[model samples]
Target: MLTHAERKRGIAWGLMSLFGITLFVGAPIIALLSWDMETAQTRLFTAYTWRILRFTLWQAALSTALSVAFAIPVALALARRPRFPGRLWIIRLMALPMGLPVLIGALGLIGIWGRQGIVNSLLLKLGLDQPVSIYGLSGILLAHVFFNLPLAARLLLAALERLPAEYWLLSASLGMKPLSVFRFIEWPAAWRVIPGVAGLIFMLCATSFTLVLVLGGGPAATTLEVAIYQSLRFDFDPPRAIALAFLQIAVTALILIVIASFPAPDDTGSTAGRITRRFDGRTFSALFWDALVILLATTFLILPLASIVTAGFKASLWGLVTSTAFLHAARTSFAIALAAGLLTILTSLAIVAAREAIADMKRPGRAARGFSVLLSGTSYLVLLVPPVVLGTGWFLMLRPLGDVTRFAPALVAVINTLMALPFVMRVLTPAIETHRKRAGRLSASLGISGLSRLWRIDLPVLAKPLLTAFSFAMALSLGDLGAVALFGSNELTTLPWLVYSRLSSYRTNDADGLALILGVICLGLAILGTAGQREASRG
Candidate 1:
């Protein structure tokens, strides 16, 4: 029942929001999709592109399988096992890799497994002549596993926890064998989450820029994103870069479709109320096994971070702090992050509102449904797009318009938000949906409207998710090197690009130091934002 003026205003706001975002993210979309199409047409039958595509899929598949395979048992143990001392902290620590930048994590891995790393150093002490190569596929696989195992574990653990206690009680009363219990109960619950997590990890690995670029070591190991960068920046092949971008989009879209097949855990309408139990002899073995598994995992994960810290401290500690480049990068990163965070929140709110309106349509005809579908699909297109390709498109388009660097930070922020939208929507949708369902009629009856409703009703209910989305967007923007690296000038470099530049020149110490500092800052902000959201939710 929106009046003519109101609807016109609403449409104006939405378009303005979209246009502002497009000024930042639109060119990237054109670049990625256009490149993909061009590649399909020109190199459609080329063996090299096909070979590259094959390797990309093959590695991602294997990596996803390996990560999920290892995570299954670990997740089950955490779910079934009693909460012992330090158990909760252990779980929190596992999520550390998610917050760590890819470059930082890669650096850590080198410290632990590099030719002259700890293991090789030990071997040297024993008079060994050979050293292991932590480069190429081996390095890529290890990094993917390190990053993904925790995600798979978290997803599976949540699923396992959702089973009603009565199922366990029945199994025990009937004296079910351990294997039988796992087959019937644990497997079914955990299997539900397997596809989602696996698909997600595969997509992540496939699109990975920093890790693959750093550790790939050669052409045989390059991913599509990395390939696009090489073609555009290093090789100066616009047509090839365009083609790679297109292929990358198609591949990403396929993966996204596969991921979409899995039912969202939030929509499943099941909650795991607490069910406590005593630890018995049989459960003790599982507990011990889990503890050992996580312990080894933790050690492997922590070593790299430790190396970064140690190395950073030993090399150029005081010099980095006083460096003009470092200070400028830090300031630029913070500014873009703040602007992107605010812009993302606004865009997300608009999209959410649009979706709600579409859903509320009494007669959601073909056109309405089609519009809804387009919006839903558009939300994910950013993820499938390569940053460098997009940057190239903008660079080409804006070259005639004069210097693009003047607005590069703002532009990059918008792209960063677009890249972050799917995740932000994922987090916010659940909280908002739950709140609206529970409080919709109450708010309407009270005649709440506009900003007042948002402040009074919506804000209280959606506070946690709002804070979560903001922090996530900010953190992601902080870590983004792909788009920023392409668009950045001396005055506009962000933290991730700065870290990469240092690492490229073999300035490992300075890179590690900056990485550690940035990681801490990001983590602290995320935690503070989450805590603030929680407090607001309670209030």
Candidate 2:
């Protein structure tokens, strides 16, 4: 057990950390709530508000349905054809969409699907007069599917891969038909993942800010997030912004409630990667079907990414790379990203320390478990409140103090820190707990506690995990477009905002060049983050 003094101190720090995060997040919410209730009700009842709400729900539902539905077949194809050419490369490619900045992804899609894009170029050559439009709800769905489908497919593929060797062997021995094998063996694993995957995709699509903002065309295509941005940045409508923010929170909470009501699938035993080789789907028709699904999914995912690369190379970026404005934005993005990552590490450390202390106290399981849930939930609390909402709240809160743009960098850093908190905690907490478990008792017996122990013991030992957390957090913050959208100004801008400006000004080539640079940096950081984790595990 930790010493009484250390335990008490930890508990205090933990409570304080939780309270601080709560306050940071709650301040904006309080700003939203403290408005004139009568005015709030009036704003709440508007036709425009209801229209945006309906569109928001409709697009998110459609995106989630399309992504998850298409993922099943793609995943099944990959699982059944493990030895196919470029299989590993195809799996690796799926992660690209997740790492690429939202603005960059949108730009990439526009290059392929826009009115004057490659698709239209080909169609014109074929004597077609009509051009495809990458605007409105059609464009929004295209972007969402481009980003989410691969994610769902990867998740489902993992589930399929986890089935034990024995199950497949039994199926083969029984001479089960292909449909029977899928129904009894594969379907269960896929089904287990579907609900949780669907919920996550739903939440992601619902809160999507940059994608919809870029492709939303106008009011008719806007999601709640985009609507909030328009209210604060475009219309200067604080009351409407606040109303939309609460609407967003309510929608998110309701989704969570519905998701919680569905019991999660229980964990199945692991195969440890020694899967029983399957001897199925060898018929001509089966081969054709698998090939078709895999081919289509790969093409759908690759076209945009390839467009980003090829089109980016064709653009002349010497002027962009040498510009003062570009340099300033890059510097600001990196500085704010670094600050946010550092802050995330500190906050995660305090929270993890509290949890370890509570575990040492050996309280009743239910009580301890409840406290753990509360602490964990504190990290994720930011997710429910989209970054745009956070920006709007901060904007309202700071309006009385003169120019909000003057405080843009600080506010963006703070919001980015919160946005990165949940993810950083996921990475840092387990590593901290593991290290503490291995070293806590030994250090305690040696009378090592407090700052000395942290610097000498924890810091030295947990360096890899800490680096991983910092780099990953930085990667996320660096590419964030949502929080920056409402806060971006001439004095304070980020790479994402800069690219968005280019896109807005009809400077597609400059945007593509900037996107390539930004995407490479973000992807490199993501790779480093995961590489650090692997190295940490090895150590």
For each candidate, give its TM-score against the true structure: 0.89, 0.94
Which parts of model 2 have CA positions greater than 4 angstroms off?
263-270, 364-371, 445-448, 455-457, 533-539
Please count the clashing residue pairs in each candidate, in the order shown.
4, 0
lDDT by residue for model 2 over 1-539, one digit each (tens)? 47888877777878888888888889988988887656767898899999999999999999999999999999899988979779989988998898788888998899889887889889989999746789999999999999999888888888887887777788888998889988988898898879988888888988889999999999889999999888878888778888888999999988877777655533333457675587878889999999999999999989999888988888877788889988999999999999999988888887887887788875547866687678888888877787888788888889899989888898888888888888788778877888888988898889998788889998887887788889888988999898889878898889999999988999888999999888888988888877866775799
lDDT of 2 at 423: 76
Model 1 / residue 114 / CA error / Å: 2.0
- What TM-score would candidate 1 get against the native? 0.89
> What C-alpha lDDT values do all the predictions have?
0.75, 0.86
lDDT of 2: 0.86
Error of 1 at 498 (Å): 1.4
Poorest 10 consecutive residues by lDDT, candidate 2: 262-271
